[model samples]
Target: MNESYKIISSSILFWFSQKKWFVYSILISIFLLNLNTPLGLTVPAYHSLIILLLVFMLVTFEPIPFPAIALLTLVLQVVLGVAPPNVVASSFMNDAVLFVMGSLMFAIAIVHQGLDIRLAKLIIKIFGKSKRMFLAGLMTISAVLSSFLGEHTVIAIMLPIGLSVIKNIDTQQADGKNAVLLTLFSIAYGTIIGSIGTPSGGARNVIMINYLQEFSNVSIDYWKWMKHAYPILMIQLVVAYFVLQFTFPSSLNNIKMRGFKKNVVKIDVKKNINHLFSCLIIIGIVSSWFAFNDIYGLGIIALAGALTFMIFGMISWEEINKNTNWGVILLFAATISLGFQINETGASSWLVLKFNELLATFPSNSMDVSWSIMAVLSGLTANFFTSSATVSLIGPLAIELHPTDISFALSSAIASGFSFLTVISSPTAMIIYSTGLVSTKIFFKVGILMFCISIIILYLMSQFYWVML
Candidate 1:
């Protein structure tokens, strides 16, 4: 009887410990809900703020799965009388959410086609001779591929290749450790730097585009976005190469890569036809996005690409369903809805007003200063939370601050992709850290340097390049 009582008591204690953060989040939200704001916020606006804070904590701490948090967020809105059922349901779907879903599907199709093997052969062919040139080549390939294929996909493809290279290294030598670190970081930093190049590169870009359109009615097409962001991407890639080289300098001049054959394998006629068709389909979809995004929208074009692959028998639904991260999509949708609420309920405006008052004490209150401040803050916040979450939380205020200037909003969103401080900052970072070769100290040492460089470059682009455009 006593043992049975202990088991019951332990089970209860375990449950409470597991759910303590959830309880705290609920209690804090309730307390804030009851309070009156001096900023003249409406009850719904205050409720939105409470929800935002709760979600921010939950997402950061991850007390439960993110998808569950997203669903709970929607449920709590109705249960707490924050919004109606129809309104909450409507918020769950949007062009941005569809774009993310379709993009993931398309990415899965591309990966399933085994293009990474072809890419690896090409990379080995190009930069297999010299160590320095190989490092540069890896970074260049990673960045360029990530710009089009998305950072996560590029990282997923490149990580194994990097690890293979590290595994072949002689760790007994003194310079061996540095070589391994350099190789891994080359892929990581490249993927990160390139994610800012285009909308397809990262989810944050899509979320920002949607927010800009919904809130400010500013429409930026695919080519236009690439035109604005690609230059910054190019410069950052060069900077990243230098940064990695300087931080983790390798004394080895050349690496003898084993297990990589120089001879090309001849493909069968049927496989060749499929490869050609897949390439053509990808080109067609991307070209359409560039040429006709204003007419059909990016989301539709992306979905069309995935459908094309499925119809052609190049990919299967099972592959996409198993590989896709629906939780991220749900989290993104929830945050976007909350962002809209922040705008509609005047919470964003109030927060912007408070920020403006704080800025009034500064020596200069110019738009440039405002843009710089927002970019830095967003960049810093992104290193802790996901970039999508940072953008969703800060985007409303950015738009409210410069309601007419789309440049400010675009710059802030792009800058937030500079997640260089921690392994958890971005998936690319996490992937690199998984190799177990990169110590946190080395990651931070290199990351802090790159972060400083990125901020400076972003600030300069905002002032000079964006002004001309």
Candidate 2:
């Protein structure tokens, strides 16, 4: 008895001294919070989702590494029985994960052999010869590429080129903000614009399509997606240019990146006809996304491109190993599984129940008044819960309560664009923010302004394109 007592006292002291007690206590609390769901305590599904979300948010901002977040996500999922080993393992194979990895592989190849920079220089030489011209040219090029390819991929490939251009330009000291703001806004707005290009341009766009096709009558295909999204994308590009002009007005007269372009072009890069062939591969893959809707999906095709890039010796297998962020891949999978949980555990319905009640009172004086009110509020909520997941939770409710209110559903859906509230808002935002160039607060400030302006634009757009005419 005495020896056991002494052992217990030593363990208690060690636990307290090492701060393990607090850690264990929190784990125990979470365990207990989730444990009662099976016993009829009626623990909210969103309660679990909220806990996971809080943990994800904290990990996102913490000094801890992203790999650590990946690890904790799985361990916590298992402990809470949110996902088991088999379920968590399956998350690793999510279509979004495959898409992300495949896209990154393509990005790696472009970044590696200097093709991306070569393309950028060729673009600048063709359209640019002056400062304002160069800026406009850059924005135009970024918008064009982002719309077709992917936004994060566009940023990864072009940011270095942009930075190098800035380095060469002898800007006046006072214009530093203009330079930084222009470059950053070019990336942010360009990316947002890019996402509107295709369903696959942004992950959320794909998710939105799935929601519509699955839950509603509109089964949008790739061409149909572009028909709706392209108009919005083009308008966004025009508005973004004006916004940038208002935000940063500079007159350097001459913008010479001649040396930069020459350096980019003349360099002896890893020459391969394979680079040219990769375009064919991409085209075939994309064509499959449209043409073979009866067959396998695009993720397989994209992943095949990545593999084919290696198998054909266009890129080395070692290169793929170096570029892939497996941690992020895992986190995406975990979040996807979490999305399922949030839906399955009655969390999504519960959330919609409450949010629908809130959406019920939009200070309606007229149809336009009610529409605009719902638009702004839905857009704002998108900033917090994310455009995809928020729409996932609230989409059905919006459709059901106001089935005829296309303006309401469409604004609420397209308002998915307002995910710039924080670094944690979207995969693209997270991808860029993980880079050290920007901060969470800076994104929030710029994003909030962008969102406010965009809310008005979306309201206007609903009148023209998506609203009940």
Candidate 3:
């Protein structure tokens, strides 16, 4: 009887330890809900604001799974009378959510076709002789692929190749650690910087696009987005190259490694047919996105591409289903829904008024100051939370501040892609961290430098290049 009592007590303790934060969140939310606002906002708006804070905390700490946090947000919205059940359900799914889902599916299809080996060989062939050139090649390749394919997909493909290169490095050499750091970060920072180049580059871009279209009636098509964002990508790539060189300078002038075997494309039978078909599908999807995205939308085109892959037997539903993180989709959908609630309930406007009063202390209300503040806030917040979540929180406020100038909103979204401070900042960072060779201290040290450089570059672009565009 005594032993049974101990087991029950331990189980209760374990549950309490695990769920303590959740309980605290609930209590705090209740307290916030009961308080009368000095800001003179509506009760529902205040509730939505409190819910947003709860979500940000839960998502950052991840005391619970992200999807659970999303679902809890939805439940609380209805439970607290912030929104009715029907309104909450309607906001949960939208074009942005669909785009995220389709993009993940398309990314999985591309990754499953064993294309990374071919890409790796091509990279080595182009820049294998010189160490600096090879690092440049990796960054360029990762950036370009990520611009079109998606950051997570490109990083997932490039990470193994990077690890292999690191493993093959002669650790007995003096510059071994530098070589490893350079190689891994080239892939990581490249994947990160590339994510802002186009809408397909990252889900956050799509979310921002969706927000602009929904809230501001501003539609930025694929090529137009590229026209605006690609220059930033190119300039940042150059900056990233220099930053990596400065941070992790390899003593060796050249690296001659022999493991990169050439993959010759043979036009022989079923294999050739599959490769050709896959290439055509990818090209077609990308072309359609660039040409007709405003007409048919990116989500449908991406889904069509994934469907074509499955229909052609290049990939399978079982494989795609297994690899896809449905939780992320749910989290994105929920956050988006919550963002709309914030906007609909006037919470975003309320927050913006408060922010404007703070900004009034500054000497200027010029566009430059506005742009810089939004960019810095979005960029810094993204280093701690997911970039998409940052966009969801800040995008509405940005739109509220600059209702006519879409550039401010676009800049904030693009700048949020600069996630260089921590492994948790972005999926690409997390993938690189999984290799177990990178030091957290080293990651932060170099990341802080890159982060500062990127912000300065982005601010300059906004002042100069973006102005011309």
| Order of candidate numbers by TM-score, starting with the best | 3, 1, 2
Off by over 4 Å in 3: 170-174, 252-256, 262-269, 364-366
The C-alpha local distance difference test score for the whole of candidate 3 amounts to 0.84
| Clashing pairs in model 3, backbone N/Cα/C closer than 3 A | none
Looking at candidate 2, what is the lDDT of residue 287?
76
Scanning candidate 2 in windows of ten residues, the lowest lDDT window is 35-44
Clashes of 1: 0
lDDT of 2 by residue, 324-353 (tens): 767655555555555555554656555555
Q: Estimated TM-score per prediction? A: 0.94, 0.77, 0.95
Candidate 3 lDDT over residue span 323-425, tens digit each: 9889988998888988988999998989888878887788875566767888888988998997988897778888888877777888888888998888888
lDDT of 3 at 297: 82
lDDT (Cα atoms) of all candidates against the true structure:
0.81, 0.61, 0.84
